[model samples]
Target: MGHTPADANRDALRAANLRRLLNPASIAFIGGRSIAGAVQRCRDFGFTGDIYLVNPTHAEIDGVRCHASIAGLPSAPDAVFVAVPAVQTVSVVRDLAARGAGGAIAYASGFSEMGGDGTALQATLLETAGEMAVLGPNCYGLLNGLNGSALWPVAHGAARVDEGVAVITQSGNLAYNLSMSSRTVPFAYLVSVGNQAMIDVAQLIDAFLDNRKVRAIGVHLEGLTNVHAFSAAAARALAKGVPIVALKSGVSKLGAQLALSHTSSLAGSDALYDALFKRLGVIRVKDPVSLVETLKFLSLAGVPKNGKLAALATSGGDAGLVADLAETHGIEFPPVTSQGRAALQQVLPAYANIANPLDFTTTPWGNPDAMRVCCDALLSDDPGAAIMILDYPKESTGEHPDCDIAAHAFADSARRYGVTGAIISVFPDLTPPDHAAQMAAVGVAPLQGLSEGIAAIGAAMWYGATRSRILEADSLSALPVLQAGQGTGSSCLYDEWDSKRMLAEYGLTVPASELVPPADAPAAAQRLGFPVCVKVVSEQLPHKTEAGAVALKLDSPQAVAQAVERMTQSVAQYAPEVKVKRILVERMASAPILELIVGVKREDDFGLALVLGSGGVLVELIRDTATLLLPVREEDVRAALLGLKLGPLLTGYRGGRHADLDAVARNIMAIAKFAQAHADRLMELDVNPLLVLEHDAVAVDALIRLDA
Candidate 1:
């Protein structure tokens, strides 16, 4: 009842109109028994709408009056469910559009979902629909079970969905299977968006976010064609506090190829998606069940402020496994402090572990009070979140009158302290427990294994951290503007001098040096200092060391003259086409503490990016590096620093003092800002051997590239 298309983007808004038609006053079936098999299923599911069958071949079928055409209908139907051959579906939709049908659910293939002539035909059909919305030429259609609206084919089963979560999948069959899965998740809406010829999923997200009845949105995305709109819509959902849990399928290269073949969509890079998720606060899940369950957790209890975990399990082995996994995923397991331990000692037996991830040793099964005591202690200790481990009671074992009571005691203490609580219930087999649904109703997840429970908790904690980062993203630095002819476009053409100027302009310290022609090298060396280095300066010379264009530790007039003559000859022979600009003469640099390589490149999809790795030619072979998106925060920069394989070496290892991390971060930040600001014109930038000397750092070599 909430569909409107007065806006110019009416085709996009048709999904909104389709939502209302999900439960219409009446449904017009144009193909009779072609889809009449679904009549009993629809009526059984409590569809009050009139089923009008229109086919000249049948007078009546399934005890319903048959009409020869939509023009012969007694009154306008809210939606038309059409199932015919690929060729006939178009004509039916065109006629339906002319008849002013609310929307058309085309259960036919051979349109845009296929290539060649079919795509052209689909385009023609979309134009014919005009203001009306078409669900699919190749899709299974949508289910607004909230109001008993089912425009799908009879082949798909019907499930009871009322006041449940809405799922949007790019694949039709997957959406049906996800809804039918025995995961105990009730759904309110399920949309299968194939090809997205008329409307995309991003608009659907926006539509759902507008509906307050929707508790959350689950997206099964194969690709994102319109990134800007998706980001904008996603930001709105996050602001409105409607979390979106997405299970993006195509991340690997092979997966990307498969996705392209499946829907004719482009699957971008994994890194780009990672950056997008971090910025948008989208909770990404590995599988469908996890997607449903995680959204359920967010919907019911909400996320904690911090992810401080206090784990308690009946088995020591289970406790250990949880702790190890939590630690790996960055969930803090702060040990019970002295004060916390003393408080817990008041109520626990002597054998209780007392510390975080406390092992109850199976003795708590006898003493029901002990469970409450441990829960109270942990909650009162004020850990950000906590979980309890229990084995599901079997029917053969009979009902434990005290088990439910004990579970309630633990749950009550958890809620009392305003702490986030979760439970891990392990079942031995596929046998569903009688109380499984009840356990879930109380914020407990019935996990099949301890590993699964740990994984869920880890995901929750990570989501909390990533969301906080997204909300706090107010400090991205402004991008720098790169001038024309900035990048020479040749990998061999080292822009060392220009790059040094760039860094110095950005407030980095640089040693004194001047570019001198080969004829004036002797005088240039004397002017700079007696001890200096002579290096060839040519756009074509990438590695001066390999080409013999570099001669170090020169101390006399004869050495300077000889080095210049030899370099001039070497560069002339090797780089014959490159114009000989000047010979760079600089003072001999002092002893170094560390050397680093700072590189930047404009990725095709994600824009500017930075790479920090080991210095020298070994950088290619050593492969010690860390990559991050541009405009990083101080905390993010420090984290990147710590992530490097050579991180310990920078922390004053082996009597070496700390190598000025603030300065290094500033340098990296400068490159990132430069790349971001000059993305349109800049191609690449590299500062190899950025020497971290005793008290300062200097860019020894620089390279920059341009697009045009």
Candidate 2:
């Protein structure tokens, strides 16, 4: 996304009026008889709106009144669907805007997706569309199930539901595929935002929030345009009791390149998007199936107040299967209390295990009363949610009747106890559509696949919990109002000593140090104290130790002199043209408890972000890091630290002294504030090996890359 000022109010108005445009009483379809135009959309959605066709070659389009051009319309239609060649799209949109069309979707290809001249033509289309909000100059169109209004090109199978998930996708084909998918997830709206010249996905999301029937919003993105706009809108959705799920493709460099060529939009850093999504209460999923499954769970069950989950199955394998996958997905299965176990013991035979993911052991098969008793005992503990595992018979063998008894037992038990109940089929294809519908009618979801169902439930619970916190904390109020403008100075790197000095100004504890030319290194080391560390200072080298430019533990002045000589020679050997300008003489501090890395770097789309993880020489090898957006509190840093693999170590592993975590948290806060202050001039800041001792944390090594 380009750097642009966020306009929530102006955008809100455009989005608010989208209801009229999307579900307009009248629509003028230009290029009436073209491929997948006017005729297909009207029939696809069963649209009963007044349709006016415009084509010079036809007197009428298939019994519908046809005008020669836009000028011949009887009245200014609220919406216009343009399906013309790429060259004619700009003029067509210009005419619509001239006559005051409420909105227009230009369903044409060969825009920026074609590159070269097409990019120029797309720009003209945006310039031509003055007040009219055009969804795309090259896209499929919108599918509005709630209002029976669709601008989509092909047949989209959907029926109106009370409230369903709304989806917005950058790829027209993806939206088309989703519409045609056999998944049981009902949809309220499907918007295909291709080559978003005027109204991007973020703006469209703001529009969709107006519809009270929208349960959740799912987005399929090639890339994001205007992150702050998304942030603002997502915050609004969070406030409005809306959940957002995003399946963001193209996170890899090669994948991003393809996305850029396909959409003419830059795939900004995925790390930035990840940080922002988690911060803003968005559930990020991997694929379209997961997106739909997750949304379905959210729409049906909402968020569970607690995560203590339980599972029931006739087979021990199914019980263990669910328990294993649930753990992998972070779903908890709370243990049954001794009292609850006693109750379950009575319901089951001696062989049946009274445990979470309890196996009923087929002892009560063909007996709904016994099944109900077993379920009631488990529900007595009042687990947040529960699922019963059953595999329906494909044929009417003698055993087919048992499946119904199990299903009815689950439905009856759940309704009686008022627990959120779900029936899981071991495989997706096991449950027939009719049987699934029957379960849903009884207030039980016939979820397919154990892993998929468990994952959806876990995600739904997490989103619900996260949204409540955001609403309570009013986190939107905490998001930074970015400081505008760019720095004029060029970027330059600073050596460790200089970097530490800058950090020390903000109250960071650094080892006692001095900067001096190599010839005076001995005196500097003596003044700094014995057992000093010497390093050749050169900002040109990003990594000093790798270049053999550092020497540690010099207990005497002679040792310091020899160390400086060796470091200077090593540095010159590594980079022959580079000069050893100075050397840093520092006290050899005692070995600390742990080494940690803390860094701040500006992302193109997400602004400044911080990274904290394992540090020292194995920083990259460890690859255990957490990324967070700026303006974080001490508690936020502390929480992030505790979540890391290094967390247990920080709490004093094997009876070691607990590092001053409070002081570390304060240090992070101070450094973050310093980064914010110099955001304009700073590009990157790192304090790797921020040593944590028994009582104090110190910056043993530092590096600052400034945008000058």
Candidate 3:
């Protein structure tokens, strides 16, 4: 169902309330001594806000006078931390809402996440909160580093930052752990959205986008409650030039199962999430470390204009390692210009390799002037970004002024050239925190660890390029309406003949065919052409070749008749129940340049998705495919086809005939349009081995399942 105007107004109001809750002028802790730590944290963070304690049992708790009840508080607080039990949490929330409070954090678990009675309690909590924003019934709550307010229940390691990345996660433990990261990721806020009973990750993202201090948003998602809302919020971020980095944890089967039991989060198709992220320019990272590192790079150095990078290292081994890792991450190192190499020759020793990922040799290692000259030469080409690998020595070892000098030179040169840059450490722990902070001050990302640094750079490059494309195209303005499917009804499968007939109306080319009785198959084949294919027309047998119900290369009437007889016997033996009454006789297609699969998968949450991949018998074995949400354009289809392993074949691999790619894309778009038209009832559709010939694309075999 679509959201009404009233719903929009309520959402706007809740967003306003959320702003006050996140950065409150006054905070109230409505519990006993258990919440004293939380109150203390706010004080330690330098939150100059009114703090109120409410407890009927104790006159004084944590050296602060306690109120008898919510009614006894001086005035409605901007934010409330309800540490009461699950059943009482709702009443506390109701009282706060009645007092016109901004928002509250339900810190106790057992609601909704525990199921049964807990689910009922959660519904009441949501209804009671009404216009007031609620964080979670089971979460640890939020830390606002921008305003120096830590509403969190436990001790956290985050410090105040004027501007930085905001990290939001479904797991409070993950949020807590990320707060303690020593990687120098300037954190503006850390939010743990537990069950998402009232406010979800999408709403938080939307709210964060309004804050100028939030340079980027990093999210750790087990699953999404609202895919559409997330897409919209991500698009807004992309347009506003604030990147979103995601760490999704439910890719594996066991992990998905665990996610469901842990938080009642349904780990929907990961591929669909990939498509959604790709569409909105959200960068996806693998681990928590990468998440922090990527956000650090984005927040500090910002995104590069392109994937091209210029790397510098003192040792040959470090240079080679950078080259290999850059290649692995799809980072390009455009060769240094003649001007750059000529300048490098003047500063460095003759043995130094003057190239991109330049090994500037140990001769100029300790010389700051030579290092700066080499850095200047490399940046002369105006590469999209640059990185200098420098690992600091242990403090016990010595001062290690060489690394510091090299870092300063790189930082100064990058600033002079106005290029995005990073000083990457080979080991995560080698970079000194003081040095990292100094580099960050000059707008150079002090990235720790070689592999992670390059990965972060790669992610930034992808975001830069993809963000430009999405903003220019404006394709994510709105998602296609999700079509409601018939509830738990038996599905009817369309036989090959019928499926082809339906597809042909939508501009897909299909071979001339006739569906006749099995006895008349030979006559129909003779009328169609000489060399034809015959297949038993039974909805039960979707895979005719596996059932031996299909015969190819029937060049004569006798061949057709014998094939039909064989197919009938094969079907009887294979099923012993299905009768092969009708047969589809079709003219044979010429040898295809390449075979491709065009399919439409209807998912419950994401709606229709178009799947394109290498087709034919090895489709499953090859397992090469790309998925896109439906209502796709022709360019989208073409790009997906080109991304496949067999995609090169379409361009005439090894001097073979080139398939008409435009024609192929058109055929796929036709299938997409057909899927959109039937989105209300279509369950699934497959066109296996959509033959890509030199001149045209044809759907030789097809099937469709619809709610009956």
Candidate 4:
């Protein structure tokens, strides 16, 4: 999509009418016969807008007045719905812009989506709509139920349209799917940003943030043209206490390739997107179903004040399954405290397990107080935000009473305690009558399966926890600009010493190293003392171990010379183009230590991400990397380091000596600060085998890339 300065100006103008234009007063349709079918559908669906049609040939369009054009309209409407021919659509939008039309839903195609001449034509349309917001040139249009403007083709009908959540999607088909699909949740508005040449999703988000009635914002993005602007808009929304849920379509390489075929979108790196979401505090969902379920919860019931969650299932198997899933998603399932157990024992029989996710055995299904006991425990005593009641209704309970009564009692307790609740029932063949309605009456929903319900609630809870912590943009400072052809070349720009020098300048503690050419290798090793390592310095072979370019633990000058000769010959054979800069001779530490890799990459969307993991050959195979956004706090850095699989190894596992982890955290913080301070000039920095000895840490090897 090609956007001009003029289009940006138009976005600024539309951003001003953030409230009124989005929730328009009365939307006027400009084409009669062409969009007569669409117009009648809107009217039939109970659109409260004054639909004035414009057709010079007819006085009425399906019983509505057909004025010649906006010039001959009865009044200047807040918005215009343009449904003219593809060739004439641009000219009509130009006229609407001239006539003080605040915005338009351009429901015509044959522009940029096609190639060559069509792109030029689309550029012209964008230039002409320079001061007014245009939703689409090839689109199904938008819906703002808050203002009674139903510009979408599908009818919302009696599907809970009030107090709705807003949607913004890059693809028009996906936007329409939200309205037409089997949506268990309600919506407030939907905008399909086809060829976002004029007004983009960021501007649309600004509009929604201003609307007090709009509870949450959901965006389905294929590509983000401007990450800086998008990040700013997200911060604004977060500041106003509105949650933003995103379903980013192109995060994986395969997914990016698929999106390119589907929407002609150029997706960037998945790692970059992950880092971006972490920095901006955006809740990223894995699939479309998860997106809807998460938004439904946040927009309606909201999250618990605390992170603790408790589950009560009739089956111990189901309870264990939910607990395992919760742990994987980072939800803290604090086991029922000693105090909590004492409280639960008073109400429950001796047979019931007094643990978290209490299983009140088979026969207890008949008792309703069993329901009250479990609900009260989680709600009043434990004080959790949400609860799940796994009910498995069966016909074989011949002598027992109704199970629905127990479910009702549990839900009633949930409402009384002001906690969000839901049901996960696994009935054999048929569903109990009015299960969803009965649950909904108590502000709860029924989950069909145990795993499915837990997954949905777990996803929603994870998002809720993350979204609330999204910080304001003011916390960040201005980033430095990257020079072209700098960090991105066929090969990295820094040699071993140059790389280490760059990192050391940025505050990282690098070991003593000297880049000694083949001639001076022995002399350098002798000066540095014995038990040193010699490695081929070539920007070409980044992972030198696999290529036989690295040699470790040389005790003598003779060994150093032989290692240098072998490395030189190997580099000549494997990587002929690389000028063997030197054989870097550095001090090699002893064993009884931990080896780790600390690296930084300039992510495409998120500026920089710091990675901490086990170093050396297993770096790729074990893949124990834990990532954190750059410019992180000291505590956050410590958390990121400790979160890794190898983190405990550094802390002395299995009676091994404890390494200096506090020094390691300080080193990571220093690296992060370096990346943050010099992001413009540095593309990547890698410190492999940062030897954690008993008392201190040493950077055994280092690599850095700078702007070319």
Candidate 5:
């Protein structure tokens, strides 16, 4: 799904046809135990849709009329919940497709999850079932609370809600765990996109984006089937004001392997996903609890207008806890205005510390009107959001009025000032379940755990600010689409001289250089001038410096000639197989204020990606890099460069070594354009030690590997 001609149209149609699978007028079941469980689930959830069971031998199942086959059904079902054996599931689904059945959930696990043979079987299942949106051949199926149409095949502890966050997960158990979380997450719908045989997470997200009933989306992912489609859907979700919070599990090495074996999904590098999430304005959570709690808070409190939040803590310990956690999560608590400080001083006790997380301890604890006045005075400054930390007294256990004043005061202040409000408990268990419902009743989220609450609030504010940025910004359709490979197998490696030559053709700054045989090294160096660098150029040696094939600061022709001979001998000792055929001679480059690494490679999952980071030997150790998909703007390049920890050094470390960022940006954009244009042929391009001087940037060393 590259920015190619027909991809957008194809994706548009695919997204348009994805909604029919979620809502079904009538559903048919094709197995026994699963059918019974589904029936029980439907009864519990109050689904009124017609349910028809199918089995050749049974005239009735669970005391409901059963069908002998697809033909015996009263009419075409909008969705089919198929739980037959693995081999026969595809045939039955194809038959349903022929009969114009709306959609299906194939809950059999023998498909791609098993390995190569299973992958082939799943492929055949998809090829045979044309235009019929089948959820999976290995899935737990869909749960819909919005319409009370439950095709789920297990007992779930979920309350029917007309509006809540829609959760989609690659793992069915994760989806179930989220639905049954004691955190009291408001769940409108939950979908398990196992193997994504027909309906992937991207399409589900796209469908959910248009359903205004879905307030937000919480996604649990192993890996994405389509990054391009997901990017398009994410941008739409942001623009439509629906925040998406994702917990990605397949980021580590072991987790990636497990994901591939589980669903035949390719786990691209985690850095790329980070960059993608940032570009699409998504908040990536670390674990499942974070995912659930964040969704719960967002559903009740709503996204704040910005990331600036004013907090309330009763004691010095609680205030310090808020400050530490908020700083760690990038949540800003800007200093209150002088007016706000004056107002707080008048409301608080004489000894209270009047700060952002103001400690107005027990001053107005039981006084709702006085607390509202404190809140109203603070609201006059219009900080993005507000939260109050309070642990309900242990004596109020099992009672409805437990901490009623605390909860009501928090909720009313938000309502009175039109700001989102939340109540936090230092420990998750301290926030009893009975009071959770009570807190929700007054429109304030009952947050649990100090660190967890702060992190969730930070994520909520990040989404709020990101959404506002998108709604006020330009269309993101111009952002690049990464397509699959097209180059032939003949593409191969180009040595340093040739690589630089090709880059120079694209207007990138490369040192003046020329390639010559070992015998001509002296003449080439003399022609280039004194103080030149000489390198034994070979396709076999990718890291020439590590291989002892490069020599720098050769002050004279004799020095250059001697260095070439020494490099050849060193290469022989390091690797006798490497052929030292020629040498590269060029005038030595003046050192820059900072050196950066710029690279481009085709990732298996995400097509063309440009990687920019701190260069040199520490690149792998530090790993301070940002990956961007191709066809990016110059502004994106500039932002990526300035985002590095080494960025301050380039901007003049202690106001002494300032390099021209505009020049660095210009070179980066040039290389990016070159990579994008040759994306099909270029397998990888590494420009290490890209010199960022006071006035210009230059590629000091390069290596190019073509696609094969």
Candidate 6:
């Protein structure tokens, strides 16, 4: 369906309001002592626009004449900062919205985050704001370094930049720290989206994408408010060539609990977040340092064309370190071309090793011409990225000119060759800020610390590759909208026979079997085949093996009859309430090359996730699994299958015959289709020990649960 006129009008209005709130021409502060600090921060940041203070108790604040209230202001301000109590905040927002104010930042704490009365109060605040954009009822507010606007209520270390990365964090403290980061990541905007009662991270990302000055976006997420919205915004960023780096916390159970209480957010499954991020082409970083470093590299050097890297260092130890770390981070160092090696041999010392991570041996250390030649030789291979390791002497020593020269030479070489480049320091503090800034000015990232710098390069490469693939395929315009499932109620389980039959209609391969009364079990087994497997078919015996209700490889009628009698006794002992009225007898198949468990898990918020992993009786002991959000394509299923720990076995491991991977993937795709079709009523589904043979794949056992 196409967007309607109402959608267009709403989008336009949102865009306009965001612009006014983010880059306002005039700002108003409404509160007590906190307003003074906010006003001073604006002045300190060189905000040239009008600044109005509204306080009924004070005639003047911070030498600026104060308006009695929002209505008493000289004119409706473009942006207002409300630092009042929760209940009072609603009235203030109502007054501002009535006066046609552009937007307001609610800086109070007691809102939806506190629950109970706070949630109702937050609803009222949202209703009162109406069309006007409201930031949060419990947030630290925003800092626009580009326009020198500080709606934030406290001091921040951000400096104005013409263009840089915009960082939006759920934690106000994290945002504050990012603003004060010494890594010198240029900042266009920093927003702490606490509570996210109104404008969430997705909306902030969308708003940032409209500004060309926002070179990239860095998000520090405790949890996402809306997965589909975030996916759409991320897709837009990918299409626009603006990279997104995410630092996602709350991955652990304890952390998720804390995150829920702190921001009232659902810290959904981390594995699902991984799938979502990968699908959207967003770079996911594990720590703050990596986030800052990755953003710095992307903002300055831009993304590399691929993962191949060419590295240079003055010492062999440094060169070796770079090689080891690069491998660890999955950054490849392609062998230097013969022509490139001949060129490097001409400039370097005779003892120097002619390799990708070439050590120039300090012979041309301070000589700019020779160093540039050395750099050019290394980069002549046309590597996707290049890095020079240079640790500068402390400024107090006054002997870092050679380091600067080397950095400049490498930057020059990278630019000449048209490859992304960075100068990495062995230690975080070794890279002087002045030199770092100079390198950044020349479009070369001056990265601190070897591990983080290499990891940043790896991330950039992944982003580039993923972005290219996504753009080429145009796969992720938006995530599939999850429909509401069946209402919460008791769920009924489909036993093995019924489950297998239901799945067979959807293209799953199941063993040929006959269901008969307990008395006819032996006759049914004889009719099927001599060697057969018999199982007591009952919903109460979902786990037949554990309940001793299953007997495998029964060769004769006598064996089948005796196994059936033992199964009856076992079921009666296991659960006396369950009657063993029926039995399933099926032909026994050959041993499988590998066993796998394919299942669909449904979460209240995240919808269905397809889980692929090693299977059989040791499934839990092995615990090797890969998860993907549903509505997945055939290629997605193939990738997930190949990424598992036992995946190597399917590819002819240790002289073993290769399993038919295509057949396996196709079967899994069938399962995914079935789950999607019954998504509304289906609660859970499991196909364990989906036997993979040399030429075929079959689902030997299955179970399905549906909302009753």
lDDT by residue (383-492, candidate 5, tens digit) is 67788887766763543253566567667778777777788989888787877887776668899888888888898888876666555666466443566476675769
Q: lDDT tens digits, residues 236-326, model 3? A: 8987999999999999999999888777778888998898787678899999989989999999999998889999997889999999999
Tens-digit lDDT string for candidate 4 (1-708)? 679987677556767643445777667777756556656766565667777677778887666668877787766667777877777888887887777777788777777767677779888887787677787777777776655576765554424456758888877777766777443455778888876766777778877887777878898988776666777787677567677888888777788876665444567766556656655556778777667666665665555555667677767887787788667666666677666677677777788787777775665556677667666766665444555655544558653245676677778877887776766664412335365546654566555545445555665566555555433224533211222223445445676666777667756767666786788988998898888888887667676877678898899999988987788787778777876777788877767467889898775555677878888777889898777666676766676667778778777788889888777877778777777777766677889977777877777677777665
Task: Return the lDDT, model 2, position 637.
Answer: 87
Give the per-residue Cα lDDT of candidate 1 at 543: 73
Which regions in candidate 5 have their CA more than 4 angstroms from the true location? 1-18, 337-339, 395-402, 467-475, 517-520, 571-581
Q: List the pairs of residues colliding in candidate 4.
A: 165-188, 486-707, 486-708
Q: In candidate 1, which residue pairs get closer than 3 Å at backbone N, Cα or C atoms, i.e. clash?
A: 22-149, 480-677, 487-705, 487-706, 493-539
lDDT rank order = 3, 6, 5, 2, 1, 4
Q: How much lDDT does each candidate structure score?
A: 0.70, 0.79, 0.88, 0.69, 0.80, 0.88
Which residue pairs clash in candidate 3?
none
C-alpha-based local distance difference test score of model 3: 0.88
Task: In angstroms, give how far residue 102 of model 1 lies from its true place.
Answer: 5.3
lDDT of 6 by residue, 1-708 (tens): 679998678667756887799999999989996678777789889899999999998898768788887877888888888988888999999999899899999988888889999899999998888778888778888999898999987788998888999999988888888888888899999988888887998899999999999999999988988876787788789889999999999999998898899989988889988877887788999999999999999999999998899999878899999999888768888888877788777777788788879888878878999888888887877899999999888778766888878888999899999999999999999888899889988899999999999999999999998878766776765344354384478899999999999888888988779999999988998889878999989988798887899999999999999999999998899989889998999988778988999999887666788889999976899888988877787887888888888888999989999999988988898898889998888899999989998988989889999988
Least accurate 10 contiguous residues by lDDT in model 6: 478-487
User: Which is the better candidate, 2 or 6, if ranked by TM-score?
Assistant: 6
- Per-residue CA lDDT of candidate 1, range 418-474, in tens? 777766655424315544456556655444445555566666666677666655664
Clashes of each: 5, 0, 0, 3, 0, 0
- Candidate 4 lDDT (Cα, 0 to 1): 0.69
Provide the lowest-lDDT 10-residue window in model 4: 477-486
Write the number of the candidate with greater lDDT, choosing between 1 and 3. 3
